[model samples]
Target: MTPADLGRPRTPSAAREQITTDSRTERFRARIKMLGSLSCQLSRASDLDELFRAVYSELAGVLELNAFVLGQYDEANQVVHVVRQVHSGTELPGGSFPVGNGLTSEVIRTRQARLIRQWSIDGPRWQVGYATEAEGFAQPESGVTVPVVSDQRVVGVLSVQSYRAHAYDEDDLLLLEATAEQVSGALRNLRRSERLDSQLQRRVTELETILASMADALLIVDASGRIVSLNRAAREVLCIDDSAILFGKPLSHVQWREWPPAARAVADALEPIIEALGRGEALREVEAELRADGRRVLSFSCAPIHDEAGAPFGGVIVFRDTTGKREMELIKNEVLWMASHDLRTPVTAIKGYTQLLERRLTKGQATPELVANFVGVLRGQSDYLVGLLNLLLDYSRLEAGRFELEPKRIDLVALVNDVVASVQAMSEGYRVTLQTPPVIEGDWDAVRLEQVLHNLLTNAAKYSPAHGLIDVRIEADEQSATVRVADQGVGLAKSELGQVFKRFYRVEGTRRLEGTGLGLYICQRIITASGGRIWAESSGPGHGSEFCFTVPRYSRQIEQRCPRGACCWPSPACWEQVSPRLRSRRAQA
Candidate 1:
């Protein structure tokens, strides 16, 4: 060796070997640099398509630029989806194909890299042809195919082909394989992100559906007390038709005083509840009322919403209408008050008369006339008490759905005359005149019918002026009989017409009258259960009122003509024959 040749090979073979080693070292360093560049590109990609495009751009620098195919393997279906394909440096449409004896499938099946150096001989053995080539492209003489693996599983395949034979060597195969492995990790992450995004979108849709369908008013506020969202019911309760004006605005910004009287009343009631929620205090079932229109009661609940860290983020408020419940409670209190007063008055009268009688008898100063008079007074008071108790019993039975009726054939005119005579005998200064058909027979409970008539006549006499004229009119069709009782009395207001049939409900002006408010309710129940209906009508207060009801008219043969499986009383045909008004009322009952 010469002194200048210290770093040079001594033999000819050694010199060639040293040159090859240096070249291989340089190529390895270049491949490592390419890999680093690819990693950076993959990380910057926002989605799967972008990541795949990045992989293709990176691979183009190191491989033959003739043909390329990037495919995702479907293991269950035994197919490969060509997601990206290029031929002669031009992009081609992608497609899918069944797994077969192709270079791509071999790489996927073996999970190994494949290098085909020649086409004519090696391609025939592997059955590689147009089936494996990109559409409108010639078969390649040389190619490298590699499996993309992640978590020790083969997920896809990557291939690059060249028209010239012996284009790809072992080094090219290794480079392609490394690139595929890097792509596998990126593909997995992109798919996972896509799944998460889809799930989050679905959850948002479900939450919106639930909020829209909720019956209670729901309001969501941000940390600064600004309205974030609200449900349909919340908008209705607040009387806000266009919610855009309120969203992102503070709850205090609502000009409650400018709203309609009823809505303003409700908003005023909710002011304190919202204030408490702003203070981060939870409240439940706080009640409020709106008295501007009719009485309406509402319940409110509020809670502070917190993040996973338990720090307060916002609050939610729910409002539920409880008007019906509060009204029921008021009616119950009224009934108890009226019942006590009515019972106590009669009992007090009876007790006073008995005490006087006892004293007079003890002193031997009671005469026959005096004794008889005392007995009569006691009996009248007792009868009143019994009648009151019976009214309560009937109401109880009706409420329990246990009230029953016994139907019998009877003359409608005679029944009305009998009820009118009885009512006139009991109440003075009330002239009740009846205009009816001479003979209209119907299947009905005679006792219950009389009770209904007596209640109507007494109610008319109690509310009418002195010597008021009450007209009882009866009409009949081929199917049913109707009776109408009208009186010149302090008529009910329009709002009170529908409520008059409800138990324990009384008109405001008639509260001072002697009634338990169950007469009309009982009458309604009896008529309704007998396949009939009752209703009240009036122009307005002081214009007089009318009560009308109808009963189906059925002969013995018609009553027995019910269908085999029918459970209803007078057969479907009988009901169909009645007036439309009667059918509508029965349906409502």
Candidate 2:
């Protein structure tokens, strides 16, 4: 129990314990400083490969290592490229190295640090480049490799070798791991930035393709009012062949330079609209007329387009040629006005004469027979003038798109009978007859339907030779009713049938017959507006012609209740009773 035995098994004193703790703390502090320095260097590098190179070179100096190799991962190629190499006081050729084999693969797969104290002890397991292996043996084959990982996924591996066995202690391993983590984070950031740049490029290409495909001229201007882009249509419209005209040119300069006055006005007014659009305002549209070279008249419209944040980016203008349409409108207005004036003069004259005769008769200043004869002539002329005015009004209403029809159930037989009676009074030398079915009920506008039948009958009377027959017929079944008007006049020539229904169209060969040339056109318009179609057929000139139209039929009971009574158009085959031989032949056919 002397002092030696009582000294607690000869353990070191507090001074020695304090020294050991201080050494360990110093080691930890050094490792931390190394990590911070390497991280700073790697972070400053711009891309993944550059970061890997910086991290490898900086760590080699901080650790005082002899030789090192950095293999940066290429995810697409599934290979690692030797991004950096350092051999203290030595030279080693640098190149890409495979990751599928040896020490690098083991570290990446396990995400762990590996150390070889001596190459002789485990040289067979350390397969690297022949140049690297040769350099390793010169340094006693002592080395350490640490996996660079981010988010628990190993991205690359960092390897450093020393010239002495067990040259790297546990503190060195800890420092290498910290540095690898920093390098991994920098690499991930670099990759993300690259992907964003690629996406932005693709979006720009897509926008260009869309603008090029647009049919209207497109021009894009920057906030500074300079032209940034223009589409193919713009180039053609501006008559500029080179793309140099668009880029960096002020929008106002290009818009006004050598442009027409109307185009200039449109461009000037559109600038503010584009500015408003940049403020996220609603797009503005403006129309202007442009006539540059007299080749055509153009109607132009400009509209503002906006950016993603709702700022006005630029404007789009469209041009449409309207020269022909405007000219046609002017011609139509003049012709109708003149025709109306011509009609008024005749009407005034007839009214004055008729009123004079009526006054004389009222005063008993004329004989009964003489008064009767004069009155008859006056009435006929007045009626003729009234008919002309009615025709003109109908044409105007139809052309103006304002006509409204009131349709009701009509008797096809009664309609034809009324039309024939009117035609007979107008032309005593012309014989008119109606051959029809028992009865037919159809939906029709009474006034318009009557006009159609009257026009057909009047035309037949005027064109037929003296005592010639004009046949009218009504044919019907459950679905439809057809009215046929056949004239034993000079039939329409083959070339005339197609043009008969056109406005102001008349057969020149039939000039002997007087007409306004609007009769057939009016007839066609009336029949079509009443939910029916009309057409004419002729065998040849002088062989006679037939006009037919079909209307949807109502039941016979409806005809009985109709206020206008039963009216009908005889069916063509109804003539069988009038012509036994023709009926027999038609039956045989």
Candidate 3:
């Protein structure tokens, strides 16, 4: 009171101006404080949802926010998604709405702050639709809606309301506009993070899918030698049916699993890969094969895999079944040795005979008859050599998988009669008899089949005693035509029956016979390749053996399989006119 008395009196306008100035300064400080706190809050918000919550929290700090809708604007789609909504003293639901629907739309379209002294969450005055329209939610007495602008464009809308009329003033509008920039920053950051997360997930799925489909049985181990991953083929190759047993097991325990004989043999062979892990070494294509009793049964390889920094982490173990390859190699080696020795014998004999003939002529001891006899012997040896060469050529063609057939229709009866006649002329002792239907016919390779028949007949004569008889039967049915060559010769043992068709195999006593062991093998190949099977039947040794085979038979009623060079048929289209029943029969044949 004493200080007031001593002070000089001023005009009312001056006092009023001073009070106004103080009030403005206080508001400016408060505004600065609110904006600063909002920036800090947004910086710490984790995602769009948290930032939305932060925006409303900041608004509550500076003004009365009774109700609000925080929406993301999609201008291209002309829609507003009310991503978050909060209200006091009213029930209102948030969702998508058309851009031009209400007060929220007004702020988005004009890109300016909007004020409505009185507003409803529903009805004609409130244009934007909400989920609470059917719930009869109350209206806001007053509100302010503003665009949340960032980077010179509006990204979304921020609206606040109060239950009291004119609850939001100019000061509230200014504060909300300033705080919206922080919200905008958060939304963009969150969207970027989500996109990155989605891309990462997709890449992981692609990698897993690729690893699962690999053809080779693959196994992956970690730095600690723990089994971490395996493919479907691994389960098959290892003969394991359960994944739980394999996924977390150690590489050291692979041999202990109940592996199949083949897999166990591989695990035993792959010791090199296991030892490399302990030595901190990397291996690539470490080829290995597993064998039992000195015979290769399986083959496989191992290679190390590296991590991101090129550090050794694991290895890939791959396996394969190589039984067929091993068998083929053994057969090929045997064939080469036998062929060389067999071919050399004939050549060596011919050389010796020529030398003797030359010496006899020079010594004046050569008679004309002796020279003629020597020439005849040479010719016979040459013919035998030619036959061997031909057999070898046929074997080569069949082994190389390139044998071809020229099929034609023929009277199998005529073929049997002609072969028997030829055999009778060549050999004096063996009497060959033929039994057949008068006109049994079929599709067959004439030249090759004739060779097959000739081989059977000659072998029969060669193995039979002098004056032995050979019975030949040619028979046909709806399905196939069969040829039986029964010889009264030294028959085969039970074991010899199966071995007779093997390459380089001959009966025990028949080794001295004038025939290479390749004849029956070649005949088997030809007969089997022509869609027939050849087999031998016998009681026991010295009794006799019957060699029988079958070739497919088709109806000769409408279609006859004609020869390649000469067609005995009237037209090539004769097959097209066959009856349906015959067509089905031929197709089955």
User: Which number leads on TM-score?
Assistant: 1
Give the distance in Å from residue 476's predicted Cα in candidate 1 to where it truly belongs: 1.1
Between prediction 2 and prediction 3, the one with superior TM-score is 3
Candidate that beats the other on TM-score, 1 or 2, i.e. the better one: 1
lDDT of candidates 1 onward, in order:
0.81, 0.68, 0.73
- Top lDDT: which candidate number? 1
Measure candidate 1: CA RMSD. Answer: 6.6
On the 0 to 100 scale, the lDDT of residue 572 in model 1 is 34
Each model's TM-score? 0.75, 0.46, 0.69
Which sections of candidate 2 miss by over 4 Å? Answer: 1-34, 37-46, 65-68, 72-100, 122-124, 130-140, 162-167, 242-245, 251-283, 295-589
Model 3 TM-score on a 0 to 1 scale? 0.69
Per-model root-mean-square deviation over C-alphas? 6.6, 14.8, 8.1
What's the CA error at residue 372 for candidate 2, in Å?
A: 20
lDDT per residue as tens, model 2, 459-576: 8877778899988888888877898989987888788888999877778677544456677887876655454679999998888888888866642333343322222212211232
